[model samples]
Target: MSAIIQIKNVTKEFKVLNRREGLKGSLKDLFSRDYKIVRAVDNISMDIEQGEIVGYLGPNGAGKSTTIKMMTGVLEPTSGEILVGGNIPYQNRAKNAQEIGVVFGQRSQLWWALPLIESFKLLKDIYQISDSDYKSMMHLYQSLVDIEPLLHKPVRQMSLGQRTLSDILAAFLHNPKIVFLDEPTIGLDVSMKSKIRILINALNKEKNTTVILTTHDMGDVDALCRRIVIIDKGKMLYNNDIEHLKGFFGSYRTLKIRMDGDLKQQAEVIQKELPDFSVSADEEWISVLVDEEKSKVMEVLNQLQKSHEIRDMQLEEISTEDVIKKIYEEGVE
Candidate 1:
């Protein structure tokens, strides 16, 4: 089947004023000001298929949001073409919007003063949804989440998790073909985070809705995304399934050890000694990635014994988080 969304060499640029320093610079007689062009989304491209959940991974200012805005029609690309469901989003925003749903972090699409049910009804009217469609959406949502207790409560009165969950439900209420979730689980408690993940997975399976998720939480990615796209500094770094991405670092194991030494300082030393492997701290443990293909785990540890002492250790397969970190440190080869 053809892709539901297609992006070809898309790029979005912005012009920012280069303000001078000091009060004299700020004044500048209001006549001379320097501006520079910034490429927030560079020449990057990808295809999103229907009924698939993709994790849009990136650091701050990595252009994930910019790409999403272009997909949703909030902004148009400065170059290249973006077609969402066979329609140009920026050119036909109204039609594009009807088929796509968006939920931004820290932003609620529901009415603050209205009850959850009232908000749902308002969305139904605004989307011109049929009565049958409305009923089905309610039925599906209620099945996924017990909304009876919170249905009558105003949105503002709901807790943070409740509000985030409600916003997600409302976004899917119209049964749009595509849903963009931006940090949907941000700031939610552990239990609430699990609930939101389950709700989303269930919705995708039941409705076959395509999901484009942007998140920093690795737990969310593990629970929700089978495939992920990694970008940094407005450039596409990696695009593939989690397994394929991990395969890039095959024969690598994470060696976690607990020691009495200062973990932060020791981790830096180990990283320097084993420049090929990535090292980090996890609470009481100093974690290091041991590339068995390059050097046996014991051989690597034997060298580390030169200065640091290991009290206890455990080894595990390279994880998604580890792969991401390694990629950031060293680009995909």
Candidate 2:
């Protein structure tokens, strides 16, 4: 399949004005202000194929929004090229807009006081959707989203789950070839999140719609995306299959030791026994991070047995959150 979206060496820079401290300083700067350039999207490039859901992930201030803005043609890149559906994104924005749909979690494209059905009607017109095609989509959405009950209620009267579901349906009403969803499941219950995921899967399967998802929730990436692109500080860190990311940071293990006696004594004994491992403490809990490939976890347990009585012991794999944190912390040094 041909790539639907192509970004090559894209970089977005912003000139921010410097603010002065004192009242006189602020007054003086009003006439002539100093500006500093900040690169938000730094020389990033990626190719997204048709009908693929790609997870664009990172920590806060990691340029997830800036990249998405450029992809959606909401902002222009300072340098590089982007082609969405064979058209330059910023240069041919109107044509690009007609080919893509976007939904940002914190912002609503729907009218606050209007009923959801009314909002859907307005979108149908805005997108110039044919009457027959609109009815067909509404039928599918009614079954897929279960929006029947809430369609008559005002958006303000709807629950967070209801609003989110409606917002997703609104984005898909036009049946665009591609969609960009930023934090689509934010602030929703588990069941609602599942529903949204199911709906997204259905859209992909039935219509072959390509989706670009930006989210903090690992579960969303795990459930929906086959490939993930991780970024940090406006740079691409990792871009490959989810399994590749897990395997790269999969060398570390989390060991939780439960003590029958005082926590202090147990921690001291473990530290003395395994000096190579990184150790930390909580009130009564003791956590040890050990390199699985280098250190033997069972050897540590055996040593702890001679010193302190063990009530319970558990070993867990480091989560995606921990993996990214470790990468960032190590990069700092």
Candidate number achieving the greatest TM-score relative to the actual structure? 2
lDDT by residue (1-333, candidate 1, tens digit) is: 889999999999999878888989888836675779999998999999999999999888899999999999999899999999999999999999999999986999889999999998889899999999899889888889989988999999999999999999989988999999999999999999999999999999999999999998989999999999999988999889977887786678878888886888878877888898879997798888777888898887778777777788888887788778878778777
In the range 2-112, model 2's lDDT, one tens digit per residue, is 689999999999998887779988897897668889988888999999999999988889899999888888899999999899988888889999989898876777899
**CA lDDT for candidate 1:** 0.90
Q: Listing every candidate in turn, what is its Cα RMSD in Å to the true structure after a full C-alpha superposition?
A: 2.7, 2.2
Poorest lDDT segment (10 consecutive residues) of candidate 1: 26-35
**Quick one: how many clashes does candidate 2 have?**
0
Per-candidate Cα lDDT values, in order, are: 0.90, 0.85
RMSD of 1: 2.7
